[model samples]
Target: MKLILKACIILIILSNTAIAQRLYNTSEKLWKPQKDEAFLQEIATTIPTNEPVVSVAETNETCFALMSGNIYALKSGKLNKDNSAPAGVTELKNKNGDIWALTDNGIFRFQNDRWKKIDDKKYVDLCMHAGKLHAATSEEIYRLEGDRFVTTKPENGYYSSNMTMLMEDGTQLHDDPVRLGPISKIESYSGTLYVLRPGKLVLFDGLIVNEDFIDWGLLPSKNTRDMLSFGRRLFISTDRGMGVLQGAALKTIKGEEGLPVENTTCLERGFDQDIWIGTERGAVRMLKDEWHYFGADMWLPDNKVNDIAVGNNVVYIATEGGLGVINFEPFTLQKKADFFERHLEEWGHKRLGFIHTVYQKDGEWVREISDNDGGHTAPYLAAMCYKYAVTGDPEARKEAVESFNAMLFLEKVSPIDGFFARSIWSTTGDKDEMGRHGSGGLPAKWYKTADGKWYWKGDTSSDEVTAHFYSVSLFHDLVAKGKEKEMAKQHLEKIAAYIIDCGYTLHDMDGKPTRWGRWDPEYLLRPYGYVDRGVNGLEALTFMQTAYNLTNNKKFDDSYNQLIKWGYAANTIRQKNVFPPENLAPWDDNLAFESYYTLLRYEENPALRSTYLRSLERTWEVKRMEHISWFNFAYGAITGNDCDLEQSIKHLREWHLEPIEYNFRNSHRDDLFVEPGYTSYEGGLKAISPREKNITRGSRNAVALDGGQNGRRIMEPTGFIRDYWMARYHGFLEAPETNDPELTSVKRRTEQQFGAEPYKGLEKPVFY
Candidate 1:
């Protein structure tokens, strides 16, 4: 016992130490140019090396390239690698028609037929901000005055230091105290200057530094990998994922949600507000509301994307492998509207209703389908299809019918004896292994018990019989629609009888009867009400209602009342947030479980209707507006909250647009660019904090924008309009009020923050 205790203590200490080290250690090695000026004359005589290009600029129809410590000018589309200028250029920018290049030696102006060096004593990072060329160094910030560089302070206040460390490893690399820390890169957006340090991001508004200008912690990542300003948001690549700075808050885009890569290398905004990300792994493009990946398999020659630039409607990428280019026509609002219309026409009208059919075999009842993948059940698809069919579009109706038929095929089960078997292959008589039978067969039936009970099956635990009951309820709803009504009724009767036979009420076979079920025998039942079991109870009640409505049977009402009592007791357990380990079912402990299932059961219980509505609101308040695939009990929660069954679905909508954190590490810089596969930013946001308001506007900066009218207008302006609307459709936010003053303020702030001014010369482009 003493040795075991010592080992546990040592493990805890090691874990804590590891966490602390990870939090504080953000250092990285700085890249040093090999043999200063070696590429200057060498490139002038020999072929250009494969060292990736850093910066590219075009002025007076001449294209100049900055690569591997040397500068080259392209004449007649041919790079002058042989006789290029002998300057180690660091930064390049074009103002009006003239090109300015900042190099290690000094600043130079390219015009007419000369490379005129702008002699200056001090040098640092350079950028064109508010139509002026500004240079920022460790000691001070300087702007061009007449033909010379002059010192200038920001509008608020200015702080200059002789000694500072700015680079990832400046403390060990540079020896000059006068050199203003390590300024890796500099960029100007709207009228503000942004500085990127090792692990920090700061903004200078021509005055004092706004310490709160951007807080990455709100959208935390492992490291500040890379950054880019596009449209109305600032995109930042971090060790874990990518972050977008909208207003004062940073919203993260994780790699787990379909990002091509996580280790972002560079970012650029294109002609149509299209944002391009170049990462260590590949390249990704965000246009309007869609994301596309380009790599070795998709036009890109390599995966190591270093930098990106836009020229003549084409995007250029520099990678370790080679240079690649992609030419894509910009998406338009008309196309977006048409697409949305088509989407709605095909799948908009289906009203999700309560399930009516439940199948019982031997002594256990079962559902018809599972909720493991994307929560697409046959009944759900049918309801969605039916809703879309009501739009008076024949094609939509046809598609809806086809989808409904497909669901029928997916949920069909063979009947046997007075009761039906759980599935075609599995018999309900094998209860011990089958555990809780649902209308749908087990995703994997290999683990079935001899008594017909499904054991700890694939991925999910065995104790979660509520999912099965919910499935039964969903199946029953399909029956009422005149599609297999007889089968649905028969299955419902069998399930009711099975429930009664199982100790007169629903209870886990392995444990004592409580308000909820358990996941497995070894696992203790959670004292918190089981969401899965509540869903089952709700399904039973819905079945009873259907029976009563069909036959006017008092027994159905009695059974429903009993189930409602059970539901109320279970809800009491959940409100306390205390669950005895012994009572926990596989799906019972999740906090969002009960409310999500309750949303579906609202149609059955009119007596306790208000209680269910309140529970939905409370769940929304607690979950915020995030979507967790595991917490799918609320698949229809949004519909319930939106319609008469509940009061407000605002929380559902809020969570749909909330951003979330996926990856949180810096093991490899390449991971910064990897795209998160098929995940929603809003879904992630809700998963983090539930109490966060969906809509908030303050000053010129806001983190999460409510989908108000202003938000919709700016959505297009910022290239996120499609996502904003989709979020609404997915019950992530309330329908936006485009005319609200709060939304107008958001638009103004977005413009001011991004420094986007309407340009007559540029073609009108679609917003995201």
Candidate 2:
């Protein structure tokens, strides 16, 4: 009933809103506060007490955050007590040889070791932009001219008190009705004034220069979080995570690359171009593309760094405990990488595998390289190889590819009739006992014997057919371009045959002949064990599409259509039919698989194309609003149309720290936890258990297991699904022209290098 109602609501909204208008619906919804009184109360109290002291300017030295509201100038790490300023200090500037500080009460100047306070009634924040000292307040903005502060608003439209200055010049200039209701705070950056209002971020590019403008909502935290300008963009720290504003969009960087602490106190620009983020848990410094944590180990006094300021080579941090100073320096990538490698090796290198059914040692079947219990090892190795490829390191690529080749020899039989065995070690590579090898059949399990013979077990279901299809498709692509052409061809043929059989039968695991396909066990449905058909259908379509590209067989095209029909059925069911609340498939999840294949195979379908654009917008909203950790980053990457590469890069960078952990019960001792570095298991932490608790964790035991990790123990279904999705969308795999301008440019350059036409737009070249 819940799923049905939710679907209805979604469909109704979709039907009423125009596409352009629909594009922003998700984002708008995220920015609105929920009605729950408790939640609202929590939000109301979530604001940080400290604001970032971005840059401190003085005539001869830099000013630093001293205590609560107090600031002091420092030269060579020594505080100039005579020039120290009190709380409520708004702006600091250097003019001629004099240091000027603006406050709400008055303006103060320091010279000859003495302080002179100038009685002034108006001042807020101060900055030196476009070669002049400017002060902006909640009411108005002004520029300093020699001995007097002059208003920047135009003389004709300027109002003395209530009127706000949208932009200011050396002289008063008014252009439009200033909307001050939404702006709570403002900062000046590179000739632009950034306004931070609840739920909105408005950028005024020409305070005294160009009149260009752009604005976007901070989707992650609605309007409750604070904003700080660091590097080339604005960073927003909300209850969920941190977000970076790019152009008119806000991209979240959470899970691993983000701070572990939730309540962010302040953000300041460090002297080495690093952004120092202060959170309740610790102080994080990001510089030269690396993030370093200063917490318990550094004697930070308190986890929360209330405010930060940099002077000369010293960094002053204000926290709940007190003020502290430390020498700051830039981080070198080489040194950082070396440090990470040491941590990775210390974590351990155990492998993970799946067993369908186990039996006592027998001579009837033999274990094959493909039948090896470590199912995830190959994909993990492949991911590592891809990483090395990105780094352009020849040695890493060689080692990764070699590992992949070793894993391939484990395949012994075909799981589906038309495809290779689902499990390489199974007697007959069948997931269940229901289907044959060549036609569209159900999933099955395969096992190998020590006597060089293979045996089969379990029920052969359609879900297994689809899983094998996807796995084989990825395997074939990975090896096809290299020297493993024959091996790739073998797997491709098996997958093609399996897909053909499925299209012909129209039957899946439930013993029902329907258009919809079954969900893979690894990619489980919500509320635990319940299975859905969308995943199966989507994977089949993907396989068919890949097959068409590989063989150019019209039969593959027909298969693709059959899969699409199932997709349409699922889509219609999701939109109009009755279902359970937890069962309703998220449009973003469906699009992760559906849109990729549609873009690749069904480019001519106008409805699909139009819906695809809308889907991307929806996906973006989901990512922006949802509290995603490093594990869920794949969802954002796969829905590439919704985000740019910059967001993907941010997520990838975060994963380097918050490594995913996998736990398995050992025979000799307690449960052992293994951590795979950033490249492996991007899907947070997960736990797996043997079907029987009595079974030992040795090589010979029959094990039962499930997987998922959500800051707590989860069953196998969620774990498997997260892993599969993460693998599917890991990194920027399919470089589309629209999504990746850099890759497109690189492709064009490669084409030029080879004297071929550039890979025009999103189309891939046909290899004869």
Candidate 3:
């Protein structure tokens, strides 16, 4: 027994030393060894055009877009009219560094920066094969010989069909087949040129034309729009799905193989190992086993993708409205965090020490005075705490202190002691609508402060309180020092004591408990309260346990023990409700995790810890598929387990640079696997990428398959900033060994704070 005690002492010393060195603000001890790696960051720059683009091609670092029967060249990232080109151009192609345009009257070659008509015969399609330019008229296949397209007659007659036309809006207009003896499209791969007829494909090998290479009867569909040479195989787009032809063996990639859309319109080879497919609805990138969707106003000018052109690390997507250019740049996670940090200031998301989302009004970005500003700012404060703990930056420390003070001010401004307001607003603020009632239809409980400077909103729910305790706990442990630490302890004591005084309820000025703030047995023990009993029990226990841990107060300890004996500990086992559709809410998981972090970290009783751990495991298992970085990091920090780090990082990396709430509808996708609404009303088997979904602030359901509105409102990027810094502090994610010197937040800070000269390369882009 003595030896065992000595060993325990040694373990305690080692643990304390590790904690002191890492300076984590949590009670739990866990850390991942820092790994050095860089992730590519995607940034989109939309180039708007008046006319719809029909086709696009890139060669020799230059891109050309054919729009409205005219050709335009993209020079220095902007499109310019190629005046020297001939009119009536229908399609453009690049063959051996030569730009060729197929016009309505003839074929033209760009020579000495001037388009010269090479052949006077109209051709339906053209391609480059075996180091020669090939064109197919209605009856004959021709090859280029000394700038002239000469006939490459075959033993068999050429297959032909009426050419498909595009509407002015760049959408394909499929007409009833007339079989007018015109080849619609032509493609070449592996020394063989494939010709598309009305319902069949014919192969031409410079001498012979036959239909033996591809058995059209075995393909997904007979009506093919486009074909692409992908590695060793030819991918043909059809209405049913994508057909793959490899050495006469035909296969299909449909919904069963994770094709998001069924009606494939066109196909293009991607910059990487991926392949780009265009549907009538949107563009799809098949990167190995994953499918990354690009649609909606956030990603494209229009969902109708006409053509796609790849350049270096960028992709130019021609749509009905304009060109959407997606540029891929090297970025570390640190650089992304820096980008969001700068975003908050440049977009005016901060007001009075609180971070806010923005909505457009009269062409200006206006800060929204949301009902849950206090609750919304909690994560920002928590982020600062983690940032200070990890970097020891004074700016982060100052920000944490100011935000904590603002949170405590919510309680101070209220008429009743220990009763915090949902939000505080100035009487003479902007004319935006202020909510006069809570979600439960309670009367608006607005009261003037003693100084008459603010009107504090009342009838606060447990959400605000939960945020307060969670962030304050972190602030005290991770950021607060000396006098500020003492202040945090007292602030927590007052709130916890107030709850006890009111019999586990937060009351308004009317001396009645707020509708959702009740945690006492009188409320939670009833059948109507069954849904909230688990989460509320968890919250109350956490408050008492955290208060006692910080202050060593016997009163808090006694109350905590009494609550545990009252079966509240057992009640927490079901804290994460997964049944009864109406009871499913995304924010409930947020509150439960906030309580779980502090309660499990500070709770010392081994038996109770086991129970809480069980609850945490159950809840996390339900949430693991979301790939939410906060939930994953919190679980990893507490349990020292592999908590989906790679998926979490992927989630973080997929965030769009712009946080606009654009409409995203994925319910019609063929590859979507809808699960039972166990966790959310619209839960799915997999969480969609943040880039393809509505902009979220961590509380929204990640599994919600479809949601959004007009792109007028923008969300604060704090959800991303907080999760990233928390991961850094907990060592779940490490700082990259190399970072883009211009994109770092430190560069912005040095220029703004230290009066440093701005380097032209480091100048930041204005987001708004």
Candidate 4:
């Protein structure tokens, strides 16, 4: 069952920028430190691209940089391979002349300048013969016999490897059969011998064996660190840079050409023909093709280089803070958007107005603005009340009047009547952190009032009265005007007249029933709030028909005609066709998409618009795989239906969403399939987080990706700014042309006053 076909991507990845270049003007300083490049120091812990250098015969008397068994040297009034060697004096490499070393206890030369053992037994490689010196050791092969190298063997296993040849003589043997170990170099050139192999370096010439002149692109087959050729061009180097192959073209020089350090271990050519290189973070000369770099802010004592021998006049570096030398200079620049606006003020903590979620802990990142602030800051206060009703911006109406006065101080710090607090810390905090932040295990509450001065978080559930009457009816229909719409219609009329004066529920201060904040009519006629009897009687008849359309009152219209004459709106269309999101759970699909937007705010009557169009055609046939742009704009704004507006603008162009509180986890996806249990009207409540990084954009049966709930943080998606300003204040959408804060909030405006052309096919085109 491998389906995954999803197509429709589209992403200009944001760069239209012009609503007066908005990053919210001025006071800009969001952290940006990458402070300029260039410099070196830090000699060891690594640098062994199988020896980026180890010399004696290419003489300057004593040059070394092998690392991983450390050894670095070079100094003579620091002579002139472009001078600079600070942590020098590690020792042994002809400290002042005569150097020759191989050791396992054998071949050690260097006369009048010290070192002497000359060759007695052990050896793994240091051979030249036909011209005097010899030694092999994989199990014997020596031929110096006078100053003594002794024993030998080449009889059956025709030996001699540096990349495989066993040709009886031509000399060489430290094998490589695809790097089965030992074989970092063998060179010879002209008459051809070159073996180097780990990422392709073969050659042979004695009757053809070329290796098609080696290619290996962004260099990396086995750290082919140093290869150089000169003139006919070969270069190679690589810890990811300097490949240059020439002729059939194979270019690569990296660190974006300025070569400050991408790892390159060693490469030498310099004497004015310039090439030098060798780095961890220091020394890169290139010349004529220009690239200087040098690091550790110039004058190395570290910066992990490991080998760079130049000779004719000093140049040695092998660092992990040990032997680095430098005649350096490079460092000056900074502004990767000021390092991404100081990496977004490195994660919040706005204390006293509650922000929390800047998480990291014990090693720091912290934000915990006291966790679960009302089932997640009511979709970030309805995304700052649809960003203060489509940018009438006075800083989005002072962040929607400070998240609507901290959600009207959660029903006025509830001293018992309207109950609401799911967050507020500091009675010196943790006063039982909402008893371990319940998802469905739903317990742990704290009260502590008077003289305690602060600390009030009772279990007023029903997802904070469905995000406080849907973000106070989006701040009383788009950013409150007249005395903030009579102070948000007098706090939604004292939180729905204290839940219709306690008869509907929410009664903490131990007046009982705060658990699951029950709905009225004696808890929906019988089974006492039976799994919250269908979205608690459709969120108490849409909060008393939105407090009887803002106090035309008649006892909030006779408590919405006494919950539609006691049948409680036909038990919310028969407990919404038996809550089938394959049997109910993720907060009963967030109380059936927050009781299907108050049955479309009373779908213009006509018998409650045919039972709210038969409960949104059975909740949009099981919530269209949750590309839930607020249930495709409230079922195309209450039943002109035909949803899937290109999978809700492909979830409003996904765009890496991370505005903080991460932890999304798609149950480690593999496409799909995994039914699992549920249905007892969903009371079992187990599924802790899977449905697309944890649903709750007012959850329409959290479509697939397995029932949710598991440390489900998911902070700011602001449900793509609450389904693009409620699909552009319900015209169903298409008005964007580009003012650019994310393409002027996804510009797209045509549909005329509302749902015209019955939303035919929804335009399409978008592939990323």
TM-score of each predicted structure versus truth: 0.43, 0.38, 0.88, 0.25
The runs of at least 3 residues in candidate 4 whose Cα sits more than 4 Å from the true structure, single-residue gaps closed, are 1-184, 187-235, 238-241, 246-250, 257-263, 266-423, 431-768
lDDT at position 671, candidate 3: 78
Candidate 2: C-alpha RMSD after superposition: 20.2
lDDT of each: 0.41, 0.41, 0.77, 0.50
Models ranked on lDDT: 3, 4, 1, 2
Clashes of each: 115, 75, 1, 48
lDDT of each residue in 1-768, candidate 1, tens digit only: 999977876675454334323321223312211110100000001112367666666655455666775666655434565243546777565555567777666777777766777765435556677788777665466788777888675332343321342344533223432232355555675557776666666676554344455534454564665667665777777756687777777777765554646667667766566788877666777678545555442234456766666665666666665456554432222223233233222221111111211223353332222322112232233333322322223443444444333333222221221111222222422222333433134334323344442222222222222333333333344223454445445544554454444433433333343233232212222444243444344334444555554445577667666666555424532342224533332233232343244233434344455455455545433332333222322333333222211112222222212111111112222222212322232222212211122211100011132222311111111112222222233333333334333322221122222211121121111111
Model 1 / residue 556 / CA error / Å: 3.7
- On a 0 to 1 TM-score scale, where does candidate 3 land against the true structure? 0.88
Rank all candidate structures by their TM-score, best first, as comma-separated numbers. Answer: 3, 1, 2, 4
Candidate 4 residues 125-155, lDDT tens each? 4434344443445333455656666643333
Tens digits of lDDT, candidate 3, 232-320: 88888888998887877778898768888878887877888989898877788899868888886777787788888887888888888
Give me the displacement of residue 222 in model 1, in angstroms.
21
Write the number of the candidate with greater lDDT, choosing between 1 and 4.
4
For residues 1-768, write the lDDT of model 2, one tens digit per residue.
999977875664343223213212222211111110110000000111243433244334455333323456554544443344545665454444566666768877766766677647645455555777666655556677876778666545432222254336524444564443244445665456665656555554433322234355445676344567664677877656677777656677664553435456566676667777777665666667545555421224444565565555655565565444555332222222233333223322221123222211232211122222233343334333333433334444454444444334333332233433333322233222322332224333334345534443323334343433334444444323454555555555555664466543333234343332333232223333234433343444556656676677788888767656545324422321114444433332433433242233333455655544454443334333222222233333333333333333332222222222122222221122222321111121212222112212111111122221321211111222222223223432222224332212211122122111111221111222
RMSD of each: 21.5, 20.2, 8.8, 25.4
Q: Residue 316: error of model 1 in Å?
A: 8.7
Q: Which candidate is the best by lDDT?
A: 3
